[model samples]
Target chain A: MDNMEDNIKCVTCTAPVNIAVIKYWGKRDEELVLPVNSSVSVTLDQAQLRAKTTVMASPSFPNDRMWLNGKEQSMDSKRIQNLLNEIKQWRKEKHNGDTCTDGLLMWKVHICSENNFPTAAGLASSAAGYACLAYSLAKLYNVEGDLSAIARRGSGSACRSMYGGFVEWDMGSQEDGSDSVSRQIASENHWPELRVLLLVVSDQQKSMGSTEGMQATLKTSQLMDRRIQCVPESVEKIKEAILKKDFKTFAEITMKDSNQFHAVCLDSCPPIFYLTDVSKQIIQLVHAFNSSCGITKVAYTFDAGPNACLYLLEEDVGRVLSLICHFFPPDKDDLNTFVQGLQTPSISPLKVLLWT
Target chain B: MDNMEDNIKCVTCTAPVNIAVIKYWGKRDEELVLPVNSSVSVTLDQAQLRAKTTVMASPSFPNDRMWLNGKEQSMDSKRIQNLLNEIKQWRKEKHNGDTCTDGLLMWKVHICSENNFPTAAGLASSAAGYACLAYSLAKLYNVEGDLSAIARRGSGSACRSMYGGFVEWDMGSQEDGSDSVSRQIASENHWPELRVLLLVVSDQQKSMGSTEGMQATLKTSQLMDRRIQCVPESVEKIKEAILKKDFKTFAEITMKDSNQFHAVCLDSCPPIFYLTDVSKQIIQLVHAFNSSCGITKVAYTFDAGPNACLYLLEEDVGRVLSLICHFFPPDKDDLNTFVQGLQTPSISPLKVLLWT
Candidate 1:
């Protein structure tokens, strides 16, 4: 047998970020991390926006240690503690009377995580980071029951990042929140023609975190309470729109829900304003662009920050992209690098040439 | 006797502008110009923002002729027609059994109107214009049942401008809207210490007029439906706050209602954005200023335009003014002209010197 230090068992995993089509704004239970309404999201390609995590366990380690990016973080965060405790309990139950393979369950764990995209740019970096951590640690400790539910313990939205394509998180009714989980609505290949474009309006960290912001909304906004009441029906409609692969209904629902989320934000006491001037201009531009086409060819959704995530069909992507560049021209040197992510390198400049 | 043309009957009146603290957004009856919810407003002094109207009826005039400011305008506008028709009908009833002083009531009317402030700047120039028109026309025709009711037919908000100081426009339950009218809540001297500061963020015409904007909101925003349902209760609280001279409660209600108005704008389909970067900066500045003081000494509200109207006490005016000038310094040449309206010419630079 190898030494305990030499027996450093490790597992690595990568998870993609997700953008909500129907947003989750308020929560019913802060302790259980239960949402007031269900939400739907699309997982970006891991190659474009992803978080990579590695977990190593060894008997020689004194305690659990975690590093985000290159810097070490405190293991005392309650969210991290919840995820760890839940996973350990699952492991104990899975092998109640059976022999374990590597004795990794009892070993102290060390976790490291990093994201390719800008963190806290309203790109859901936390979701990907927490999802990757849960995936990697579960693989390392051989804990396998309801991974999404375990990820939800870390970040409410993290559960949705566990799957690709369209996914919806049901804001479960159970008092224990045992039923609150993310389920895949469609596979990545279900709508191959669809494309997403993120406009990084700003890289600044948000003044208010989503958790604190939602708490304020839940407490103060009467409109938020009303919004939550209508969301259950909206969730069903959105699911149907996704299954039908109907872009019009999907785009309308996505844009309307985004607007309503921001509306509730504004209604929140001491109101949270997430959309900046650039964000408003983008919204107007999209409306104008759709009006010109006489159909909804594109849709935009903003999270808790100013960045705009636009969705469009593959055929219309070039046209809308060209229009965006024209309306919001980048600085001379920044033109070439104006856009980033999966479509940038693959789509030829020739495609935009015709649009210009 | 004078020549027939010299026998022209004329009357002129000036009306003060009104700023809605509890905004009236949607119209229940477009033809009647009836609001879906009640609203309250503070009537500004005519020395600052006012509309002056002169109506002359002469048998020599072939048809109704109208002039806005100095330019001749078509008399075909339905809003203008509504005001004229209502005033004339009132005249016929008042003198049906008595001999009229002159046959001026049978003559075609020639009207001239002008506003001290910029029209379509969300300063409610139309409210003042219609109020002045209704007032002047009533004086000429010697007809009086309810001038505000006739003004409401011209512009829904104009009804609020008919009264001085604090005014409330009741969204009457009557089907004919005969009961819908403006009533004075308090006299102009009720709170003499209260002062208003208008920051002219922009004088540009709004992309969507309030009428069209509200139509969109009523048609599309479900949040707006819920908002209207709560307005009757809000109106009562606002009335109580005003009567009690409770600045804290008054300011909180004003700020929250303003934010809710804009929130519904965002919830509208294809969303209407009325606030600009400057408007947002002003909001944040006001919040920061209030937070520093540990009390709500000042309150800011925005209409459809980007301009911000701040309310504060006379004692706190100088310090707040200095702070505003510091954060939003005008060009050196514009410093003298920074503050507009009634307070501009009367208040010397010496007043601001006390704080600076």
Candidate 2:
């Protein structure tokens, strides 16, 4: 709500990160970030990894200002410009000038965003960052219609973070990308027993960004054609597995898709290597651990970076966690350091909320 | 030739190792070593990396005896038995006892094989080893017709080594493997300027043997099906490249095929990791070097080991070799010790030979 004295309207929203089970790799349309195949992801608990974004609109401000994690950044970037344009178009179409004053829609805005976790920790911060920005700004402007589509214009994977549950982004066939949007497949409450562990393999920035890597893959990878053809079947199977809470099938498919993604990277001309030696060792260790138990108790998947995100049932999480600690003891200096804000203190304040 | 007083007949032969440009990763029939797809290779110089074999047949010996690199090994292995049986059947069918003594044909045989380079250097010794054994025995028994076919029974890639210069192993469609044979694509002297440099990255034995690796790939790799379907096209293109003496296309196809083979390994369920960190570094360095040269002056390929075999024109070989020595300076201990047999002294005697 605006403070009438200053003519300042402000809104704050937090969005959690979403980890893809069926990965989104090559893009059909690079400009709109339209994926070659549909993808599904599990939205993580916002208490553990969330981006808190605040948007303030004021007619007195001369220009739009943005800050990310206390560092001021340019708002003239293409992605930011695209998101701002789409939201403004939506506001004009929905409100019909009924509740808006003249020049109010053209007011300059300030955006301040921060993340609880390390930005370079290989976590999907952009997904949460863009999602939070889109949601908070939409609330401040009274914009209507699909917010996920608005977020998709900013970052493709960010569209999935708009919902707290299992989400799927359909790689729509429309040329304008009007039909390409993310929707929640099921609520987070559907699989209450499922637990995800973030194995922070590194805190360094990736050598190849996802955008650059995907473009090279599309241009050079011979296997990309075959992978796109087979991914639709994988998406359907993973979605069904999530609905039924089938950990074994889900784990197998997740691991396979991760490996296939890396394989495609290797198949690229001059090749792109995202996984480090540690990432590879983690892969072997997970398989060995699962084999030791005589069943699939844990599954590991890696994104464009080396960090591994593992999925398991609540009953087996403790055992696997203990195994990880035993093998990879934490550094002595980091024993008392609170890196990730003490690990999601309680579940009470962790609910995913939609900004109104 | 036989000396009646000594009651012994002796034959000596040498075969060169073949470096696959298009690899053979899976088998349709494990027992017969029938490949799922055809493979093309360049048979290297025997003088540089060869397997030498000596076969002796004597009425005085009590039983079959074999020695590998001066150490005695068992002759009861399945592969050894298959090679012996195939040659015996060929001998009986072709010669028809016209010039053979009935008792001499049943004499006991002894085989001794040796290699100058490190057997554990990942140089595809088995290809040369079996090819030499098959050729030597065929000479000893006065057998005729398709010695490469007989070598195929010993080791699949060994069949390709039976020929000089460029070679291809046809993955026959017959269930009985009756038509599966290696054919010479070109003579060894076809491209005299072509040089292959063996960068022995490591002398360690591979953790997984090719037979075991291929079996795992066939059982688990999801991409293996697509790879097999597309390899016939690759085989044709590579053959064309070699015939046309188009070094750029040959290099591109070689590098691509190597990456695809490793990709299939990664796609395998439970996955097989054959390339080490050093191998990956070599790949990057090769690309960087080619980019710097503004052309594909050198190309590198790896088998199921970390060692890299690079193909370049004789003119560029010195530049690449100097580049390698500069980048990967040898340790003090290895300075005096000539590993991989002092790195191909000269191209004078280094010519692929066809066994007749």
Q: What is the TM-score of chain B alone in each candidate?
A: 0.92, 0.91
Cα-based lDDT at residue A11, candidate 1: 83
- Give the candidate number with the greatest TM-score: 1
Q: What DockQ would candidate 2 receive versus the native complex?
A: 0.58
Residue B77 lDDT in candidate 1? 87
First chain of candidate 1, TM-score: 0.92
Candidate 1 chain A, poorest ten consecutive residues by summed lDDT:
A347-356
Best candidate per DockQ, number?
1
lDDT to native, each model: 0.84, 0.83
Determine which window of 10 residues in candidate 2 chain A has minimal summed lDDT.
A347-356
Distance from true location, Cα of A133 in model 2, Å: 1.5
**Chain A alone, TM-score per model:** 0.92, 0.92
